[model samples]
Target: KWRGYGVATADFGRADVTWSTQFIGKATDFNADPGDLGYRTPNVFYHNVQFAYDLFEKTRLMVGIDNLFDRKPPFIQSWTDANTDTMTYDLLGRRYYASFRHLF
Candidate 1:
Protein backbone atom coordinates (compact mmCIF):
# COMPACT_ATOMS: atom_id res chain seq x y z
CA LYS A 1 0.00 0.00 0.00
CA TRP A 2 1.10 3.54 -0.71
CA ARG A 3 0.17 6.74 1.04
CA GLY A 4 1.23 10.34 0.63
CA TYR A 5 0.51 13.82 1.83
CA GLY A 6 0.81 17.21 0.16
CA VAL A 7 0.50 20.70 1.55
CA ALA A 8 0.64 24.22 0.24
CA THR A 9 0.62 27.42 2.25
CA ALA A 10 0.44 31.10 1.52
CA ASP A 11 1.51 33.83 3.90
CA PHE A 12 0.07 37.31 3.88
CA GLY A 13 1.43 39.51 6.64
CA ARG A 14 -0.25 38.32 9.84
CA ALA A 15 -2.53 35.86 8.10
CA ASP A 16 -1.96 32.60 6.26
CA VAL A 17 -3.88 29.95 4.40
CA THR A 18 -3.03 26.35 3.89
CA TRP A 19 -4.36 23.51 1.76
CA SER A 20 -3.49 19.89 2.12
CA THR A 21 -4.24 16.53 0.60
CA GLN A 22 -4.06 12.95 1.78
CA PHE A 23 -3.81 10.10 -0.67
CA ILE A 24 -4.31 6.39 -0.15
CA GLY A 25 -3.47 3.96 -2.91
CA LYS A 26 -5.68 1.10 -3.92
CA ALA A 27 -5.22 -2.12 -1.98
CA THR A 28 -6.20 -5.73 -2.23
CA ASP A 29 -7.57 -7.84 0.57
CA PHE A 30 -5.27 -10.78 0.90
CA ASN A 31 -7.79 -12.63 2.98
CA ALA A 32 -10.27 -12.62 0.13
CA ASP A 33 -9.92 -14.77 -2.92
CA PRO A 34 -8.96 -13.01 -6.12
CA GLY A 35 -12.35 -13.69 -7.63
CA ASP A 36 -14.25 -12.70 -4.51
CA LEU A 37 -16.34 -9.57 -4.54
CA GLY A 38 -14.99 -6.53 -2.75
CA TYR A 39 -11.55 -8.04 -2.88
CA ARG A 40 -10.01 -4.73 -3.79
CA THR A 41 -10.45 -1.17 -2.71
CA PRO A 42 -10.06 1.87 -4.91
CA ASN A 43 -7.65 4.65 -4.16
CA VAL A 44 -8.94 7.73 -2.41
CA PHE A 45 -7.92 11.29 -1.80
CA TYR A 46 -8.90 13.61 1.03
CA HIS A 47 -8.66 17.39 0.96
CA ASN A 48 -8.30 19.87 3.82
CA VAL A 49 -7.90 23.59 4.22
CA GLN A 50 -7.05 26.01 7.01
CA PHE A 51 -6.88 29.72 7.69
CA ALA A 52 -4.95 31.46 10.43
CA TYR A 53 -4.63 35.00 11.63
CA ASP A 54 -2.66 36.66 14.37
CA LEU A 55 -5.12 37.87 16.96
CA PHE A 56 -2.39 39.53 18.97
CA GLU A 57 1.32 39.80 19.31
CA LYS A 58 1.46 36.48 21.14
CA THR A 59 -1.81 34.84 20.21
CA ARG A 60 -3.13 33.27 17.04
CA LEU A 61 -6.49 31.92 15.94
CA MET A 62 -6.99 29.23 13.37
CA VAL A 63 -9.86 27.45 11.69
CA GLY A 64 -9.76 24.47 9.38
CA ILE A 65 -11.78 21.81 7.64
CA ASP A 66 -10.93 18.17 7.25
CA ASN A 67 -12.21 15.95 4.48
CA LEU A 68 -13.29 18.98 2.53
CA PHE A 69 -14.99 16.91 -0.14
CA ASP A 70 -16.69 14.55 2.30
CA ARG A 71 -14.90 11.64 0.71
CA LYS A 72 -16.12 8.22 1.77
CA PRO A 73 -13.89 5.33 2.57
CA PRO A 74 -13.68 2.44 0.13
CA PHE A 75 -15.17 -0.90 1.07
CA ILE A 76 -13.05 -3.89 1.98
CA GLN A 77 -14.21 -7.48 2.04
CA SER A 78 -12.03 -8.60 4.90
CA TRP A 79 -12.99 -5.78 7.21
CA THR A 80 -16.55 -5.68 8.46
CA ASP A 81 -16.40 -2.79 10.88
CA ALA A 82 -18.12 0.15 9.27
CA ASN A 83 -18.06 -1.89 6.07
CA THR A 84 -14.68 -0.41 5.27
CA ASP A 85 -11.07 -0.38 6.34
CA THR A 86 -11.10 2.21 9.08
CA MET A 87 -7.39 1.89 9.69
CA THR A 88 -6.38 2.65 6.11
CA TYR A 89 -9.24 4.90 5.13
CA ASP A 90 -11.11 7.91 6.44
CA LEU A 91 -14.39 7.09 8.15
CA LEU A 92 -15.32 10.63 9.07
CA GLY A 93 -16.88 12.19 6.02
CA ARG A 94 -16.01 15.77 6.92
CA ARG A 95 -15.10 17.73 10.00
CA TYR A 96 -14.32 21.25 11.08
CA TYR A 97 -11.90 22.50 13.69
CA ALA A 98 -10.77 25.66 15.40
CA SER A 99 -7.71 26.29 17.52
CA PHE A 100 -5.99 29.01 19.50
CA ARG A 101 -2.31 29.24 20.29
CA HIS A 102 -0.32 31.47 22.60
CA LEU A 103 3.36 31.68 23.32
CA PHE A 104 5.15 33.21 26.25
Candidate 2:
Protein backbone atom coordinates (compact mmCIF):
# COMPACT_ATOMS: atom_id res chain seq x y z
CA LYS A 1 0.00 0.00 0.00
CA TRP A 2 1.38 3.33 -1.07
CA ARG A 3 -0.02 6.81 -0.87
CA GLY A 4 1.05 10.33 -1.62
CA TYR A 5 -0.24 13.85 -1.32
CA GLY A 6 1.56 17.14 -1.57
CA VAL A 7 0.23 20.61 -1.87
CA ALA A 8 1.55 24.15 -1.63
CA THR A 9 -0.18 27.41 -2.03
CA ALA A 10 0.39 31.06 -1.32
CA ASP A 11 -1.44 34.21 -2.03
CA PHE A 12 -1.42 37.83 -0.92
CA GLY A 13 -4.67 39.19 -2.23
CA ARG A 14 -6.66 38.40 0.85
CA ALA A 15 -4.20 36.52 2.94
CA ASP A 16 -3.71 32.90 2.10
CA VAL A 17 -1.17 30.24 2.89
CA THR A 18 -1.15 26.50 2.74
CA TRP A 19 1.26 23.61 2.93
CA SER A 20 0.48 19.95 2.98
CA THR A 21 2.22 16.63 2.65
CA GLN A 22 1.26 13.07 3.48
CA PHE A 23 3.02 10.04 2.18
CA ILE A 24 2.83 6.49 3.41
CA GLY A 25 4.95 4.03 1.53
CA LYS A 26 6.77 0.87 2.44
CA ALA A 27 4.61 -1.95 3.64
CA THR A 28 5.07 -5.65 3.61
CA ASP A 29 2.99 -7.80 5.87
CA PHE A 30 1.28 -10.46 3.90
CA ASN A 31 0.39 -12.41 6.99
CA ALA A 32 3.97 -12.19 8.15
CA ASP A 33 6.32 -14.66 6.61
CA PRO A 34 9.88 -15.08 5.43
CA GLY A 35 11.71 -14.70 8.72
CA ASP A 36 8.93 -12.90 10.44
CA LEU A 37 9.71 -9.99 12.74
CA GLY A 38 6.99 -7.44 12.28
CA TYR A 39 7.50 -8.20 8.56
CA ARG A 40 8.24 -4.66 7.45
CA THR A 41 6.42 -1.45 7.91
CA PRO A 42 8.33 1.74 7.68
CA ASN A 43 7.99 5.02 5.86
CA VAL A 44 5.56 7.60 7.05
CA PHE A 45 5.37 11.34 6.66
CA TYR A 46 2.60 13.72 7.49
CA HIS A 47 2.48 17.50 7.72
CA ASN A 48 -0.11 20.10 7.06
CA VAL A 49 -0.69 23.82 7.48
CA GLN A 50 -3.35 26.18 6.31
CA PHE A 51 -4.31 29.79 6.82
CA ALA A 52 -6.87 31.92 5.10
CA TYR A 53 -8.34 35.34 5.68
CA ASP A 54 -11.07 37.34 4.09
CA LEU A 55 -13.37 38.46 6.82
CA PHE A 56 -15.17 41.02 4.82
CA GLU A 57 -17.48 41.13 1.85
CA LYS A 58 -18.71 37.59 2.17
CA THR A 59 -16.84 36.53 5.23
CA ARG A 60 -14.20 33.84 5.17
CA LEU A 61 -11.79 32.46 7.67
CA MET A 62 -9.91 29.23 7.98
CA VAL A 63 -7.16 27.65 10.01
CA GLY A 64 -5.66 24.20 9.98
CA ILE A 65 -2.96 22.03 11.48
CA ASP A 66 -2.90 18.31 10.99
CA ASN A 67 -0.18 15.96 12.14
CA LEU A 68 2.45 18.64 11.80
CA PHE A 69 5.40 16.92 13.44
CA ASP A 70 3.31 14.65 15.60
CA ARG A 71 3.26 11.45 13.66
CA LYS A 72 3.26 7.96 15.08
CA PRO A 73 2.05 4.94 13.22
CA PRO A 74 4.54 2.36 12.17
CA PHE A 75 3.61 -0.96 13.65
CA ILE A 76 1.40 -3.38 11.88
CA GLN A 77 1.25 -6.97 12.89
CA SER A 78 -1.74 -8.14 10.97
CA TRP A 79 -3.51 -5.17 12.51
CA THR A 80 -4.32 -5.47 16.16
CA ASP A 81 -6.82 -2.87 17.33
CA ALA A 82 -4.39 -0.01 17.97
CA ASN A 83 -1.10 -1.58 17.15
CA THR A 84 -1.11 0.50 13.98
CA ASP A 85 -2.41 0.41 10.40
CA THR A 86 -5.65 2.02 11.28
CA MET A 87 -6.93 2.21 7.76
CA THR A 88 -3.66 3.35 6.24
CA TYR A 89 -2.32 5.20 9.32
CA ASP A 90 -2.71 8.61 10.93
CA LEU A 91 -4.28 7.85 14.27
CA LEU A 92 -5.14 11.43 15.10
CA GLY A 93 -1.78 12.43 16.50
CA ARG A 94 -1.96 16.15 15.93
CA ARG A 95 -4.98 17.94 14.70
CA TYR A 96 -6.36 21.48 14.92
CA TYR A 97 -8.75 22.99 12.49
CA ALA A 98 -11.16 25.86 12.07
CA SER A 99 -13.28 26.95 9.23
CA PHE A 100 -15.92 29.56 8.49
CA ARG A 101 -17.35 30.67 5.22
CA HIS A 102 -20.32 32.64 4.02
CA LEU A 103 -21.66 33.56 0.67
CA PHE A 104 -24.68 35.25 -0.70
Best model number under TM-score? 1
lDDT of each: 0.91, 0.87
Poorest stretch of ten by lDDT in candidate 2:
32-41
Q: What tens digits encode model 2's per-residue C-alpha lDDT throughout 32-86? A: 7855666888889998999999989799999999988998888777777987778
* Pairs of colliding residues, candidate 1: none
- Stretches of candidate 1 off by over 4 Å are none
Q: What is the model-wide C-alpha lDDT for candidate 2?
A: 0.87
Candidate 1 lDDT by residue in tens digits, 2-100: 999999999999999999999998888899899777788888999999999999999999999999999988777888777788777778789999999
On a 0 to 100 scale, what is the lDDT of residue 103 in model 2? 95
- Candidate 1, position 80, lDDT: 70
- What is the lDDT for 8 in model 1? 100
